[model samples]
Target: MNNKRRIDQTEIAEVSKIDTYKSIIESLLFVTGEPLSIREIGTIIRCNERETLEIVKEMEKDYKNRSRGIKLISSNKMLQLVTKPNNSEYVQRLLKTNVRQSLSQAALETLSIIAYKQPITRVAIDEIRGVKSDRAIYTLLEKSIIKECGRLEVPGRPILYSTTEEFIKYFGLDSMESIPSLEDILNNFGEMSKNLKSE
Candidate 1:
């Protein structure tokens, strides 16, 4: 009976540790505002992948069930916290007041291609769009919505472009997977661009 009680106490302690770790991970996600891989999070929390993933899954479930403004989103084994989509209108209003910069049609097209097919080269982007993307790429980089990931191992070692955390935040998406399809983007953003131009 004494041995059984000791085992139960040990289990309780282990559960307590997991709870503490979950809270720490929540704080990290809130502050980072970027996707963090399981490996990265494990290193920071001093836990293994299995443990970290378990905690993250539980946290995700909790956020989903609650009526919270922020939720946890995981993609490609990476995790990030973002405001819920239903709250986008309020956030966009605030952003419009503070941010005067906006993406042009060319810039949006270039960014869409990059967001959908990240780590893509500028040459490939121009080929897909059938036009020069130098100006668009430069604009996106200046806005910090896209960044150079690295050089492709092809001819001339062309630079690869990928969307940044700011892109995810600007779109109010939980993760890259949340990005709309090209058709949806065109249909929806067509209306949006008109509104922006009118304003």
Candidate 2:
């Protein structure tokens, strides 16, 4: 009976520890309003990354199942708390400002290309679109949707571009893996174009 009592007490302690960690995580996310890497979170909580990830995943599932006003989102191993997308209208009304403006078709195409083939160069982007993408790239950069990641090693060493965290948030994606397959996108585009041509 004493051994069983000790076991129950141990279990209770473990549960209390997890609850404390969850509360700390909530506070950190709420205060920062920025994505926190799992490693960073673990460091703050004095836990290993693997354990932190499991706890965070549990929190994510709970938030999703509860349909809370705020939800947690992750991308590139970084986690952030954000207002639920469905509540955007109310948020915008409260702020008296539009959340975001629509992008141009050219900008959309450029963004798609960059999102799928990131760390890509301007020349490669132009080649794929069969047109100069300077304006579209500029627009994306200005909007903080994409940024120069690095420079290619080849001659002329053109700059490489990659989608930003803002890009992921704007698209309501949890991660880059959330992006639909390129083949699927191309197939859908092909069908649309075929229908347009037929009409």
- By lDDT, the best candidate is 2
Q: For each candidate, C-alpha RMSD in Å? A: 13.1, 15.2
Q: Write the per-residue lDDT of candidate 1 for residues 1-199, one digit (tens) a residue.
A: 9999999999999989988988999888878544567899999999899988898888887898757888887765777777777887788898876342567898899998998898899999999999988767866775689999999987699999999999989888999879778889689999999999999
- How close to the true structure is residue 197 of candidate 1, measured as C-alpha lDDT? 100
Pull out the clashing pairs in model 2: none
Model 1: CA > 4 A from native: 92-199
Which ranges of candidate 2 are over 4 A from the true structure? 100-144, 147-199
- TM-score of model number 2: 0.54
The local distance difference test score of model 2 is 0.87
- Highest TM-score: which candidate? 2
